[model samples]
Target: MQMLMYQECIDACFDCMVACNSCYDACLKEDDVKMMADCIRTDRECADICALAIKAMQSNSPFAKQICALCAEICEACGEECQKHSHHDHCRRCAEACFRCAEVCRRMAA
Candidate 1:
């Protein structure tokens, strides 16, 4: 696939990656780190996948579509986890970015 065609998805993935990283850092600093365990884990995982997806798309990898599908799934899961802690600004922003990334990834995968 042409990189141009995947620009939107790439941008979304980048945004999600940043949001997830920020959320992960913020969660670790929260008073109740134990309570933020799931969110922290999900954020890390989501950020990793988003980074991978960006690389795959940038390289025009043959598995780009498949990678995107998995990225979407992980993004959705991360979004749900972040949404649970949405009262926190970082979590809320992360959730929004994850959901947007998931949508963009789904379209790219299709």
Candidate 2:
């Protein structure tokens, strides 16, 4: 029963990780990659944190809630950064994914 609840959060985290990776790659391909430095860095951190959050939840770690809390923070920050470059479809998608992940993480953490 509890596993089912965490499953949803795990799925969201996985999806967000994928979206962040894609967005980071797309940003690097842009004509002005340097302009997306912050986005790139944040996206990478968000993706890594999402993966860690998923793992922590899956293992039922004692610190799972803490990991989810940190994940939510990074996800929100990444979402904001991506939203700033919403002109890019990849960035928009990443932002949406990050927002979704953050919501799920927060719910699970609480």
Candidate 3:
């Protein structure tokens, strides 16, 4: 069978979700957890959106493009938040994944 359309975006979504979860957990473990509250919230939001976007893309939902667009926006927001504390290895890694995911999602939405 031919490869599905938007496969790259779907894969990126999954990868970003995993990275977001890892970053969220790491943020919780930090000594200054309060500083990471926004990051933690956004990470979870980004992860959830990425998961839903993958489902929409997989089934070729009419809203797949819309989902991808939203996912890209959320990824950007989460990535920016992660970038604020690049000293944390987990945050840095998550920021990279989110940026990559955002790029693919925008392409798929186009």
For TM-score, the strongest prediction is 1
TM-score of 1: 0.98
Model 3 earns a TM-score of 0.96
Assess each prediction's global lDDT (C-alpha) against the native: 0.98, 0.96, 0.94
- Across residues 19-110, which tens digit of lDDT does each residue of candidate 2 receive? 99999999999999999999999999999999999889888899999999999999999999999999999999999999999999999889
State model 3's lDDT.
0.94
Compare candidates 1 and 3 on TM-score and give the better one: 1
lDDT of 2 at 39: 98
Candidate 2 has an lDDT of 0.96
In model 3, which regions exceed 4 Å deviation? 1-3
For model 1, how does the per-residue alpha-carbon lDDT over 6-100 read when each residue is reduced to its tens digit? 99999999999999999999999999999999999999999999999999999999999999999999999999999999999999999999999
Two-way lDDT contest, 1 vs 3, winner: 1
With a 3 Å backbone cut-off (N, CA, C), the pairs that clash in candidate 3 are none
Rank candidates, lDDT, best first.
Answer: 1, 2, 3
